[model samples]
Target: MSDLNKLGLAEARDALRKGDVTSVELTESCLKAIDDADALNAFVHKTPEIALERAKAADARIKEGDAPSMCGLPIGIKDLFCTKGVPSQAASKILEGFKPEYESTVSQQLADAGAVMLGKLNMDEFAMGSSNETSVYGNAVSPWRRGNDDAQLTPGGSSGGSASAVAADLCLAATGTDTGGSIRQPAAFVGITGIKPTYGRCSRWGIVAFASSLDQAGPMTKNVRDAAIMLETMCGHDAKDSTSAELAVPNFEAMLTGDIKGKKIGIPKEYRMDGMPAEIEKLWADGAAMLKDAGAEIVDISLPHTKYALPAYYVIAPAEASSNLARYDGVRYGRRAHLAQGDGITEMYEKTRAEGFGHEVQRRVMIGTYVLSAGFYDAYYNRARRVRTLIKKDFEDVFAAGVDAILTPATPSASFGLGEMTEADPVQMYLNDVFTVTVNLAGLPGVSVPAGLDAQGLPLGLQLIGRPWEEGDLLNTAYALENAAGFVAKPGKWW
Candidate 1:
């Protein structure tokens, strides 16, 4: 209890239960940490008032002996999730100053369980970028920096703020949405744990949409156990979301027995891409060795369509984004463009979008629109959908052949310095998702666990892809890996 801000979510929960610490004290500690870490720009909006009020109420619930486990927990919410009157811009100017009258189902459920919201963390505009640089406010700097270097680093995006905040100890944990490796990639880059649940495992209602089919909400936490606890609180079948699965909620924490004996973990040979760094390759092999030592059977497998995952994801995600973002054309809500005396509605839309969106978001919107156009719909969008089906089948076939989960490198490299990837070629930036897009394309659950560090001392993560709706078993496997890796390294307080 000496440094309340440094406690992990599980530790803080226990402290609150033992009367060793009060919810209000823990909330204040986190608020102080948030204020001190402003240089990182993790929390775009601070909500100390709402957080303290919720903490007091949570204390009352705990005193009544009827509180849930998450009750009295102080947490950070991603800016993408609508939280009553809080600003929920997905880091885009198009939705500047827009606050929903209601809350997203995921946030509402967390509130119902007595989790206090510290504030909305920043993210890529409309969850479009790999680095958090696309945010309208500015980039969320990673707490981790290269040895003896002052250069700013990315915390991987679009969940960059979530990863940064959790890594910097600004909050116990934070909510993050993954479209194409958003949550897992950022978590991996920051040396924390993040899990992207199976698509539709968490409700999408009220959360800003990027890709209707691929977008899913999950937790970025300090460890796999914390992720298991948080994910249970965030998931449920929502009547408002047609895609939300109708299923019984399982206690994911209860299933983390760390006993993967006889479990078959697949090593997709295609993941060994040519020119991948020696560190990443060694880290992946080390991760597999750890799992093998944990009594899990390591099986060499093939995901035949793995090579097409990135292209298919780019096509499908953008296609869905164009359709979803059409509502933001200087319309009913959000920022509107000024009009000239002779200008008409079309001119207003053109000017508004041009000014509202960032370079990355606009690029994606244009690509999406082009593919969905009548002249190229079949050639681009239709073919991408076909490739998507094949990617899903690749996972289905692997699992059908007794593979419990798939293991691979989370990112091609460790966190890179901000501004390193100039616009010289955008494909270089897109390659960050090479290993992660397959999970989103397959609509399967994937978790990134901090495994090792590179020569520069930056953290590297190993990803574990699980069967759909089998997150409990997946957490168990991740727990085993986490224990074996024993990665407790933290970033020096450069921020």
Candidate 2:
């Protein structure tokens, strides 16, 4: 067998069940790897002690012949997910000392299915930035490199840490949430596979709210099958989230097939925006050609409302974020600063929030509040909602025309330098989500798979979008792409 360091969840679990390995042994290997790779900044909290305990419990269950699908597997939990005693800060200072008393429905589900928790992974503060620099902890350097130079490049965000850790095999797979392009973009940069299931497919009860209407947690892994296994375990209905879909979460693992032989795939013409890099455009065309090579019929399709997606997403996500963040007014459960000598409670709140939140975070709050305010709600927020409906209608129309799925580039380009984006105007940063945000607005399933690489040696990713709740189709197509691309999930140096 390959070194335990490189094994994925299924491989380790199968080895353990057959008595060829022990959970303690696998967990120890991971702990050692994390210990050796401190510069990656992938972990916000490393709980080796608890990880060992959980691994032992998994070994006990296996001994009794009651092993679950995830028995003996270690998975990283994004800091955004609430873990009872773990600091789920969402990489924000306002919640610096905050610890949840309960686990998120998604994390709890994963635990119940027998996946061992490695620790909390890093993210952009409250899951905000496209590059991981918004993190209070610091940027997560990609495990990839262009050549011999070790200049740090972004791992992508707000799930950059999760993608970096999984790609490095610090943990088998990590949970991630996508609001705009958080999960998919990072996975693309790290050369891994990640899925953002149809909105409402995964419950959001204990995942920290960023843009609540757009955020949905999913998985990051080395390959498509692992993504399926993680998704099947964590996705289901939860009464705590009223928006959680009551529809059955399919057995995604059982449904992954390379037999998209007669599938009809749509390539949206609207995605061909001017100024997109030549390499990115070529990657998309190559991806379409691969699908055609695999017996899938590719057709040109128009989602005419695509131009409005980014503008509408910005208005709606910010509007919702403003409302969601109002709960952190320094009184209920987050950090609060002392007031000026003669000031009152209101001033204390103002001081605390001003000191605690980062620049981008503050910007979103202001934009959100502005759009939702009475003076501008109709002009900005409501108009965006109407455009959101149009974006949804475009997808519905295409699906009605017998399109099995839609394919597009995951991001406009490969991972830019970490500081390249952070130094940019905030609107320029928001433009990074241009291709991925519309699917979120429509509440459809989407995924990003490694397609190829740009000349800079950064990996390119292709996204697959499925009709509402059709994650099975999304994973199936990703699997086909993974095989067609012949990509290997290898990190440059970390661990």
Candidate 3:
């Protein structure tokens, strides 16, 4: 009927269940959109054959009258998720031509629920970098433009493809992973909704590990309701992953009553950094005002260890990254360097890594190795771990003091141009995660709700951080924020 791909997840699911439309029709619409939107480089690996096949099966399942809320919905899969028989490269060259014979637990769950996979979307190489610039397939451009300017902006990463595709209406929703704001930052930049559930809520069985402790898979969608529905389908305990919480999955969509009365939302004083954009500051205040008007109490709170989150994250993430990435030394899977006749095993390892990893991935791996090395372990890695503990405790103390949720700006500012940050000082790029890393360290749930637009017309989002194991409550709060903000802006389809 009316452009099937334009419908949100819940809308499409209802339509499919009512016999108003079939999953095949919806999947085909998204497939055509993916072909038309290739200039954005969002879908790195298109699987039209599999998508259509799955769509046909989903239609049958829908006819049987036992389909889930996500059943027969077309969605984009982030390249990081291992889809058995499909390329699961993590947008890195080292994993070139590597296809996992096993499906990632989250994707498998989604598939089991009858969600049709349109294709694997692009992302930052190995989920590194703030922008999508590190993707081997190329930069995934934001659909938004700044006031008649043709210059391209970044749909924040490493979930840029998910953001870009969803904003452009290429898919109903998409899967994304957050290590340090990867999902929320991109969703904020593109004016959509993304939520990183409480750590260990979703199993990390087949998703390539960047930082095992911090990395988590979640849903990015057009609205809070859609996000809630998709998140329910994505989260579950898996015996394959030890970190996965052995807790029962809740009906997150059903929990969205939007009545946030008496919810005490905390405003962290430390998030008001020096030189913060007046627009972002005002947006944060506006979001707090919206929540207050919705009957939630706004209270000022302190997270004294907030200043150390970035430094601690850099140290801890890279240190874990160093260990997790060590398995890719050309012996088991993925790309291998052509060895010279006289070259030894050591030479093969060095050559393979040197040839495979991009500059940013290499830099992090080196930093990770350095921190975990003999002399600096205590000075850097161990100390950073202790700071992480302090950061987690800060959130715990606030929540223990009766705070229901915390509010902050999702990104320091709206999306910037693609090549704005240079390699000379990569720290500038790393600074993008300043507002989000604390949630990861604390293993709590957080959501980004597109609240307003910047002066340049780029989308700006407000974040809600919730208590551990309370994603249902968090999604309810985000639903309130989304309803209050009334943000319906969409990027013009220039691609």
- Alpha-carbon local distance difference test for all models: 0.94, 0.88, 0.95
Ten-residue stretch with the least lDDT total in model 1 = 1-10
lDDT score for residue 243 of model 1: 94
Between prediction 1 and prediction 2, the one with superior TM-score is 1
Please identify model 2 stretches exceeding 4 Å from their true place. Answer: none
Q: Pick by lDDT: which candidate is best?
A: 3
Clash pairs (backbone) in predicted model 3: none
lDDT of 1 at 63: 85
lDDT of 2 at 74: 86
Candidate 2, residues 1-495, lDDT tens digits: the string is: 445868877677778989998888888888888878788899889988889999999999999999777877988999999999888899998998888899899999988877889899989999988888988888877778776656787888889999889888888899999999898999988888889998899999999998878999999988898898889988999999998999887888888777789899999999999998999899999999999999999999999999999899988988888888888878878788876689888887788889888988898899999998889999999999999999999999999999998989998877777787655578888888998999889988899999887776778899999888889877888888888988874656733
Q: Which residue segments of model 3 deviate by more than 4 Å?
A: none
* Candidate 2 vs candidate 3, TM-score winner: 3
Residue 194 of candidate 1: its Cα lDDT? 97
At residue 137, give the lDDT of candidate 3.
Answer: 95
C-alpha TM-scores of all predictions: 0.99, 0.98, 0.99
